[model samples]
Every structure is written in C-alpha cells, then in structure tokens.
Target: MNNEVIVTCAVTGAGDTVGRHPAIPVTPQQIAAAAVEAAKAGATVVHCHVRDPASGKPSRDPELYYELVDRIRASGVDMILNLTAGMGGDLEIGPGEEPMRFGPGTDLVGGLTRLIHIEQLLPEICTLDCGTLNFGDGDQIYVSTPNQLRAGAKRIQELGVKAELEVFDTGHLWFAKQMVKEGLLGEMPLFQLCLGIPWGAPADTGTMKAMVDNMPPGAIWAGFGIGRMQMPMVAQAVLLGGNVRVGLEDNLWLDKGVYASNGSLVERAVDLVAKLGANTLTPEQGRKKLGLIKRR
Candidate 1:
C-alpha cells in the first residue's frame, strides 16, 4: 500500500445525472464551487466537465470551460486542475434500419476539435481517453481511434500539459502503452483506470488488479469505479499501490439511500485513506509526485 495518495475529485461529468441528485453542479459557477468544496475537503485534484447552465446538459464550449477554470483560480484555492478531453466523441446511432442517421445525442468531432478548451485553458492536466467503447446500453458509443489518439496525445505533449491516459479496459491500457512506446506521450505518464461504467471493465477486484498490474513502469496512476463501487475502489486502488478518485461524477450517494455532495464524498475518501495508513497528498505534493508544473 502507498504511504501517500493523491485524491482526485471529478466534480461534474458529462453524464445525464442532473436532477437525479439535489446538487450536481450544473452551471460554471456551480461546478467551480464544487471543485473548491472538494479541495477544502482534502482533494488534491479536481477533474472538471462544464455543463449548459440553462438546460443542465453536457457542453464543450470553451467559453464555459474558461469561466469555470477562471472562477476556480480566482478563488485562490490550491488544487490541481484536470480538464476532460473526452467529449466531442459521442456517437449516438439511429435506431433500426436508419443507422446512417445519427441521433440527437451525438456530438462527434475531430480529435483536435475536442481539445479546443484544453488548448485555450491549458489546465495542469487533461484526460486522453485511450480508446473507444460501447459507452452504454444504447446505440451510443465513445469513439477514439488509434490515429486520433496519436494526434491528440502529440498535441497535448506539445502544449506542455500532462495527459492523464484514461483506460477503461485492458485493450485501452495496451494502446496507451503503445502510445508511450511510440513516443507520442511524455515521460512519467499518468493513467486513470475507469471501472464499472456500463459496458466497460467491470468493477471487480481481479479486474482492477489486472489493470494495475499491467500499467507501464514509473507511471503515476489512479483508479475509480462508478455508482456503489466508488468507495470500494478507493480502498482497492490505495491498497493496490495507486492513487484514488471519488466524486459525484462517478457516484451520487454517500450511503445506500443518501445523496452525496462533492465535498462529502471527498471527506469520506480522506478518512478511508487515513484508515488504510495512507495520507492524502496536498496539491503541491501531488504535482511533485506526478511531475506536473503548475500553470497559472
């Protein structure tokens, strides 16, 4: 088990979770506030995804991201910022024989287009989903071809922003290492093992351990699971010699029937890590550990 851990709170995801919880941070202001709350509760990093203020739907507008990051910085809260570059890859296929007609949920775009916010905002870290998957129990799929991933990884490296390679399955992990081998990624790569998301890797002890065992040497990695497996994975990740992630983006409840705020989830994670004889690292410590140079 790691003696020190970095706790990352994914403030708001692009999932359809709004209105399902009392506080899901819809607008930029709300999202920023959630990040600050998580930081105060002992989160070393905040993973953010902006949403439409009016409709509470996921958005990829750079303006919204700018405002969110700006608000967090202006608050004077010390936390490593991690932006999601996984948007703009949603492909919602049409039902039945009209497969050519994409559904309204589709927001597919080129690889670089997805990084517009990252290029402009230049957060300390941004995620690069290593591969695609059948995202959910629908016609929707998250598309990230190998070539597109190569281009995105290269651009992120050029921008001097740390790329958090998000691996959802063993194949994704394999391709991520390939990118490193191809020199598309920089030294000391960061990875996030995503589990229990619909049709991705299931949140099982063996599955997480297998992924952890396959990570490249000298890499900084974190792991998280969705829904009820969130807290369990925190312990699993820490005991398996990696960092941990927890937030409303992955799970909504603090207990069986209780809804959780971003801060509360982080607070619980801090306690869990402490119970396991590991202390949560500060943002500065996390930066040093991950080899990240703070920007702005």
Candidate 2:
C-alpha cells in the first residue's frame, strides 16, 4: 500500500447533481467556498467545475471560470487548483429515430475551444478527458475523439500547464499513454483513472489494478469511483499504490441517507487514508509529488 497519499477533492462537477443535492456549489461563490472547505478539510487539490449560476446547470463560460478562480484565490487558501476541461463535449443524441437531431443537452465544441479558460487562467493543473463514452443510460454521449484529444493535448502542452489525463476506460488509458509516447503531454504524465461511470470501467479491484498495471512508467496516478464506491476506491487505490480523489463531483452522500458537502467528503477520505496507515499529503507535498508549480 502507498504510505503517502494525495487527496484531491473535486468540489463541483458538470453532472446534474445541482438539484439532487441540497448544496451542490452552484454559483462562483459557492464553488469557491466548497473548494476552500475541502482544502480546510485536508484536501491537497481542489478540482473545480463552474456552473451557470442562474440555472444551476453545467457551463463552460470563461467568465464564470474567471469569477470562480478569482474567488478561490481571494480566499487565501493554499491548495492546488485543477479546473475541468471535460465540458463542451456532451452530445445528447436525439431519442427514437432522430439521432441526428441532437437534444438540448448537446454542447459540442472543438477541443481547443474547451480549453479557452485553461489558456486564459492557467491553473496549476487541468483535466484532459482521454476518450468518448456513452454517458449514462440516456442517449447522451460524452464525445472526446482522438483528434480533439490531440489538439487539446498540444494546446495544454504549449500553455505549460500540467494535464491530468482522465481515463474512463482501458482504451482511454491506452490513448493517454500514446500521447505521452508522442510527446504531447510532456515528460511525466499525471493520470486520473475514473471508474464506475456507466459504460466505462467498472469500480472493482481487478479493473483498478489492471489500469494501474498498464500505467506508463513513472506515471503519477490517482483513481476514484462514483457514488457509493467513492470511499471504497480510496482505500483500494491506496492499496494499489496510487493516490485518491473524493468529493461531491463523484458522490453526494456522506453515508446512507446523509447528504455530503465537499468538506465532509474530503474529511471522510482523509480518515480512510489514515486508517489505511498512510498519511495524507499537504498542498506543498502534493505539489512536489505531482511536480506542479502553482501558477495563479
């Protein structure tokens, strides 16, 4: 088991959890507060996603991102910030015989267009989802083609930001490694093995171990599962010699029938890491572990 753990709290995500949870970090202020709370609860990294403040829907507006980042910075918190570039890829295929019609959820855009905020803000780390997948039981699809990924990777490299490769399955991980081989994501690649998302890799020991086994040499990797598997995967990931991630982005409950805030989820993860006989890393230690220099 890994003795030192880096806990990353994904404060808010693009999922439709705004209405589901009592507190899902809708506005910039709320999201920033959530990040601060998670940091205070011992999260080394705060992975954030901005929302449409008025509608509480996921958004890719650079202005919203700017406001969110500004608030987090103004809070005087000392945690690594990781913004999501996984937005603008949702292609909600039309139901029935009109797959071409595209639903209102469709937000498809060019890969580089998705990184507009990343380019402008230049956080310490940003996510690059490695592949496409049929998101959920619905007809929605998270579209991240190889060409889009290549262009996105190139842009991220040029901006001199650390790319957290988000691999939803083995193929995504495969392509991620290929990007590293092609020198698209710099020398040392950081990976986030996302699991338990529908139609992707299931949350299980075998699958997590397999992904860990296939990670490129010297790859700094972390893994997490969605929903109820979130905490379990934290321990599983640590046991497998990888870091861990937890937060409202991947789950909304602290326990059965109990709602969770970002801070509470992070506290739970920290306690789990300790129980595993490993100590959670501080922001400075985590930055050093990931070779990240805080940039804005």
- The true-structure Cα RMSD of candidate 2 reads 0.8
Query: Model 1: per-residue lDDT, tens digit, 232-294?
Result: 999999999999999999999999899999999999999999999999999999999988998
lDDT per residue, candidate 2, 1-296, as tens digits? 89989999998898889779888999999999999999999999999999999999999999999999999899898999999999999999988998999999999999999999998999999999999998899898999999999999999989989999999999999999999999999877999999999999999999999999999998989999999999999999999999999999999999999999999999999999999899999999998888888765
Q: What's the lDDT for candidate 1?
A: 0.95
Indicate the worst ten consecutive residues by lDDT in candidate 2.
287-296
TM-score, each model? 0.99, 0.98
Please list the C-alpha lDDT of all candidates, in the order they appear.
Answer: 0.95, 0.94
lDDT of 1 at 25: 98
Reference-based lDDT, residue 55, model 2: 96
Q: How many residue pairs clash in each candidate?
A: 0, 0
